[model samples]
Target: MRQNAERCTAALSAAVSNYVDIFEHVEGQIIHAHQKDQERKRNCVMMPSKKLQTFLSLPKKQMKKSLSETSELEKELGNYTCALHARLSPNEHTAIKNSDYVKLSESIGTSVKQAKKIATTVKLIRNVQKQVKKPEINPSKEFTMAALF
Candidate 1:
C-alpha cells in the first residue's frame, strides 16, 4: 500500500512539473512574438516611402505657386483700380461698370466673370475704407516730475 501511494505521489509531481514547463515555454514564445511585433512596427514607421514624400512635396509646391500668382493678381488689381479712379468724374459713382470690367478682363487676361468678382471686391474695400475713421491723437505733455529723476 505504501509503494502504491508513493507511485501516485511521484506521478502527480511529474504531471505538475510538466505543466509548469509547458507554461514557461508558452510565456517565452509570447515574449518573442511581442518583440517581433514591436520591431516590425518600428521599421514601418521609420521607413520613408517615395510616394509619400512626393505627395507631401507636391501640395507645398502648388501652394507656393498659387500664393505668388495671387500676389501678382493683387498688384494688377491695384493698378487697375488706380487707373479707373483717375478716369472718374468728380460727381461720378464709384461703382464698377460693365465696360470697366471688360477692359479689366482684357488687361488682366482673365474672364469677364473673374473681373466682375474682382471689381466687387474693390468696391467692398472702398466702402469699408470710407466707413472707418482715423483716430485723433493728442500731443504728449512733458511731466515736471521727470526732471527730479
Candidate 2:
C-alpha cells in the first residue's frame, strides 16, 4: 500500500509539470473578470457627466415651459370660476350676498362659515378679473395666481 501511494504521488508530480497550471488558469480568469469590472465602472463613470450636462440644461427650458403652463392653468381656472359664478341663479347669488351662511352652506354642500368664505373669495376674484380685463395693464398691476390662493 505504501509503494502504491508513492507511485501515485510521483504520477501527480509528473502531471503537474506536464499540464497547464490550474491555479494560474483560475488566477487569469479572476484577473480578466476584475479588468472587465474596472472597464465597466470606467464606462459607467463617463456617462453621468454627459447626462448631468443635459439634466442641468433641461431645468432652464423646463422652467420657462412650466411657467407658461402655470399661467395657462391660472387663466383657465379664472375663466372657469367666472363661468361658475355667472351660472349661479339669482336666488343663490342673493343668499351669498346677504351673508346668509346657513342657506349658502346647505346649497353649496359645505359648512356654514366655509361656504360664506368661499363665496366671498370667488366674488372678490371675479371683481379683480373684471377690472383686469378692461385695461391693457401694467405688468405690476396684472392679477397673479398667488392672490387667488
Best by lDDT: 2
Residue 19 of model 2, lDDT score: 67
What are the lDDT figures for the candidates, one per model?
Answer: 0.52, 0.57
In model 1, the runs with Cα more than 4 Å from the true position are: 1-4, 45-149
lDDT of 2 at 7: 82
Q: Residue 129: error of model 2 in Å?
A: 1.0
Q: Put down candidate 2 lDDT per residue, 43-101, tens digits, no spaces.
A: 31111234223322444445334435567544554555655555454556788678777
TM-score of each: 0.29, 0.36
Clashing pairs in 2: none
Candidate 2 colliding pairs, count: 0
Worst 10 residues of 2 by lDDT: 44-53
The stretch of ten residues in a row with the least summed lDDT in candidate 1 is 44-53
